[model samples]
Target: MTTPLTPHITTPITADLLRGALDLEQTAHGVLPHRLPARARAQCADGQLAMAESQPSGVRLVFRTRATAVELETLPTKRVYVGAPPRPDGVYDLLVDGRPAGSATVTGGSTLTVDMTTGTAEHRPGPPGTLRFTGLSAGVKDIEIWLPHNETTELVALRTDAPVGPVPDRGRKVWLHHGSSISQGSDAASPTTTWPALAASLAGVELINLGLGGGALLDPFTARALRDTPADLISLKIGINLVNTDLMRLRAFTPAVHGFLDTLREGHPTTPILVVSPILCPIHEDTPGPSAPDFSDLSDPGDPSDLSAGRLRFRAAGDPAERATGKLTLNVIRDELARLVEQRSADDPNLRHLDGRELYGEADFAELPLPDRLHPDAAAHRRIGERFAALAFTAGGAFAPEAA
Candidate 1:
């Protein structure tokens, strides 16, 4: 540890201290964690993918220390959309000795102003802020600071009342998952509360979440990234992003999915890879996507500040007739993914197909309707996580120890 920075010892943030990120880029201010590697990033220039990969959904700082109090210095980029209701400050969850403890948020750092209507964004730099956690039981314990799932954060420093060091890996399997915003934690309460995080917790596995919001298009670079990642179990939550973006049709979609799986298979021939279709999204279930924000629900359009009065909603604008022209819908993609998985599994026994609806289907929607008709709410995240654990981590399941 470096010399005391005032009353606490400053532990230099290093790659060894980070979990769930694929690469760490040293910046002038701090170390920036990235879900995609440098080579993969260079291969694609999509802005949404760039921002999503940098937000560190499943990333966290892990270490061992005896400190009763700790402070994390970070440079976080908080996204703000013009004319929309104010978003809550990014949350950093604390875990001590493998249990929920406390949470904090950095007050200020940088701002990313976005014009959602125009699909453009601007970044304004600011000084770093600190996240402080005080009062803990005495003696040594493992510590984890889960980064904000929605904020792009740069790790600056870790200061504690006592010395800190990286903890030894506990030899748990690592599960790598990639999906859309719902998986990126669109409206989840906190970083650790996201469905994937919760599922990983329940399943007792380390997690590497690449659930990029609006970034799960079947891109070659992303396939390469997934191929390079080392994982014991892998899953691709396909269909939602493809439908929402309307980037491809049946002719292209079929081969792209195959190529993506082929790339991953190249890396780990026998790794259990689960192909999950889109969850129960009623709007896009049969009707196609290219979903757009539906501000029509607003009681007072003039007073955009009342956005909270009515939740932000989305509507599928694609014509059902387009489905005849090879346009993809959630239901259509589900059928294709299922058929593809069944055919591929004949030769690749480790591969499996899971209907996303099984995790959150019609009954689930009745119990916990998606708040925005797009993303799952916190309760839904918990339900999906619990259900996934029961289905995938139980005996004879794809991720089960014996099954592997």
Candidate 2:
């Protein structure tokens, strides 16, 4: 038997040791492993940064960086959200080098937000102010805070708590993942429990969380984001929200998905990409989503009841033959992804796909009944995280030890 390679571990960091000037570019920023809250009192105790969380009831955190400028990027890795339902008004924040530079706010009532913040910045929130750091220096002496709950927060990470030393390069490997709310981390106990963060930790790779709440429409913009990002390994979790949101027509969805995948190929070239469909949702499994007009809001013409059925937003596998053939249900998406990868595999050895149900399905659902009967809870998040590690990062998986 061969020996397992031991990773170079660093000394534990301390706040007292972090005091001084630092550089963000030259030194490495320790990664945050889980989702954390945003309240000062709560954050002071937990000290974990919010790596990712469900959208809408969005999460935020503060980072005290010594680097003169900071950059924030989103990974396509996903999480699902299930709660009292997050407010459409939710937004994500970014503090540069130390000061609040820019923020991503919910716009046009759109449920998706993805943008990278860079350059010098300052505090910009108007009320109920969050912690603000003054001028920051450079060389990795900084703290990153994570805020999961509107009422609670946590301190997540630091670059220079330990003694200053030559920072080793944390090789660049993009981790791309996509999925519904569970991937969006709907009701996870804390932000960190989300599967994407957990998987990234075990793999030791950069993350790009693209899980959108009720908005993974497979839209071109989303495809654009995926296509543009630099990824070493990619995974997509489809289904769930499409069914839950009852957003589209089957006819329109088929091509949209094909196009989305096509776009991603344009950018990644040869990087490994995984496409994942949704977990099992009993409410919409065999039933068709409600598509009649939502009387409450004429602008929102789609059937509100459809959202409750738990089906993909745009398409459904209504034909028995198609279901048998695996056409348009969550399973259909999974199968189609497999087919896509198979067709492309001959030319692109990097393409791969997996079924979301493999991660969590009927039996798992029985163990963890989602509060909303739609999204998974914190326990489920842990289960999903473990499952992902087994498949995506293990020695037997597609990626090599380092790439994972």
Candidate 3:
């Protein structure tokens, strides 16, 4: 008499398990997580927003299972800049019972090659890849599979050695955060390791990260989205995106911020709203932008390897004199944000402002320079996340339990 074979369980991926994404679109192969809802996406035809939303920087697959082994099949759309340095493979982090258990990386996926000089991009199809993790602890355990923060992933399938079910909510406060690419996990090691993710874990809060890369231009729709989304705490990291993109002048900036806050207050009348200015970016600290790629020291174009080795840097192209004409820089934006929050807090006691410099100032910058002079690297992400948690989530802090 032979023993019966143990059966594996396959659960269909659904929205309930997802936390940070605003929308989920079912594809023929599987599902794609989007940070912006269909309505929001429809409002803006900007390619940057489209790309940023599709990346799902803070999105993860969460569940509870007794399984000892798990596997996820995905088709990630990896981006490649034609003349820029090669990016590392996207990492999928697995957490068991709130702790990191294992990690894996997909080997193959579609490639999106972009020419920054020409502003043109092309997509090339590639094969799907699988991530497998085994040797989990016994008994029921909470599990989270964090998607790559940089790559746009399409989930294909999930398999477990045992049945999986939704984890019961621990009644954690939901923190809704909005910001630019640094907050979008650029140069971050993994999804769960992103600054927002790290802060959320430390604060024991569920996160709804709206950290759109290059898309955090203080758009009315984004503020509207924040207003509609439910959250116990909210934070906005503004300034860098505006400066780097040279999106607006001080004349237009102040009113736009007020309008954005007004829209958010309409829905969250009493919620704690923290306004964080951009962290230290020396390149744009005083220099006005539209930041431009600096390929100045790069070797001659014939060799792709040399081209790849040539580190890409960004320079502020806007003149310092432009400030007299109402042009905005990081320093100017920070000052404005501080003053705005202070003025608003007189009547709106829930408003608070934290100097972004306190999080990553000159001292920290000297120790851990930004890799691209724009986005923070993995180690810096940790430093910023830890600092944010200590400053904003601890006692007497903006998001402290008593404050909330």
Candidate 4:
């Protein structure tokens, strides 16, 4: 227990307390978390990748402290699409001894405004904000402060009423997962509530989430980053991003997946690697995409007020016949992934494949629909998380400890 006489401690936020991020950069205000290291970032200059990596989806600060009160200062850069509905403020979740304790949101921070039609963006600076939690339990215990999953956060400083230190490692197996926006926690209520986070908690494995939003196009740099990171278990959720982004044809995607897996095997030859295909998205299951925002329901000369009213939605716009030309759809990609895994598993027994639809299948979709015709809502996140844990982490499952 910390006594009133104990002097307040101010600790510089460093890598020791951070989990899930691959790299950290010293910024003018504080430390900025990056999903990819500087070396990986240097190899590619895609704006989408830059934005997705900067948002700390699964990153959290973990430590043990007796402090009754704690304060965190941060500079969060929120993204605002021009003429689109304003996004809700990102929430910060706090946990004590692995249980939910409290949550908060900062009032003011920077904003990055984007004109999607013009493909231009602008930065607007705002003041740094503070988040404080008080009247916590007195005994020394583990504390986890999960950063906003959707916002680009720059951690400034941490202050506590008592001394703080990094929690000793519990020797849990590390699970490295990479995927698209859904895995990046697009509609999850908070960072810890994301499916991967939930599954990690249930499975009792440390997590390193590389689920970049629009950036999961199987870029070589990301493959290199995955190849170098240490992990006992690895999973890649592929397909949807490639299909929606219209980034590649079937020919290119098949080779890309092989190359990506080849790179990862270079570092972990026998580590358990699970390749998952895309979940059932009604709009994109048969129709090809580059999906675009849908505004037809709004009045003609569409009301900007309606835009800000949170009625934004997306629709798959590509023709279904394009599949004949090698353009991929969700169904086509899933079949290809299954075939690829079946072919490769003959020799690489450590490699396995899971159908994503099993995680969120037709029945599940009918019950809990995707709000934006893309990302799953909160309830769906829970369903998917629970299903994933039971399917992959249970006894004799591909990700089971003994399987490794």
Q: Model 2, range 1-404, lDDT digits (tens) per residue?
A: 83432222233333222211011111133322222112311333211112222231223333333343322222112212321133333234443433344443222211222111121222222222222322344456433322332222122232222233333334657676655556666666544456776676566665556565555657565566567656678777766655544555466666776777778889877777666666776655664443222223323435442323322122233443444433345555555566766786788666666677777888898888654556677788788888887887776666666444
lDDT tens digits, residues 219-331, model 1? 88888888988899998999999998888998899999999999988998999998889999999998887988876646675533244553567889899999999999999
RMSD of each: 2.9, 14.1, 2.6, 2.3
User: What would the per-residue lDDT of candidate 4 be over residues 192-303, giving only the tens digit for each residue?
Assistant: 9899999999999999999999888999999999999999999999989898889899999899999999999999999999999998999999999898877655674454
Computed on alpha carbons, the lDDT of every model, listed in order, comes to 0.89, 0.48, 0.89, 0.90
TM-score of each: 0.95, 0.57, 0.95, 0.96
Q: Please count the clashing residue pairs in each candidate, in the order shown.
A: 0, 62, 0, 0
Clashing pairs in 3: none
In candidate 4, residue 143 scores what lDDT? 93
Q: Which candidate, 2 or 4, would have the higher lDDT against the true structure?
A: 4
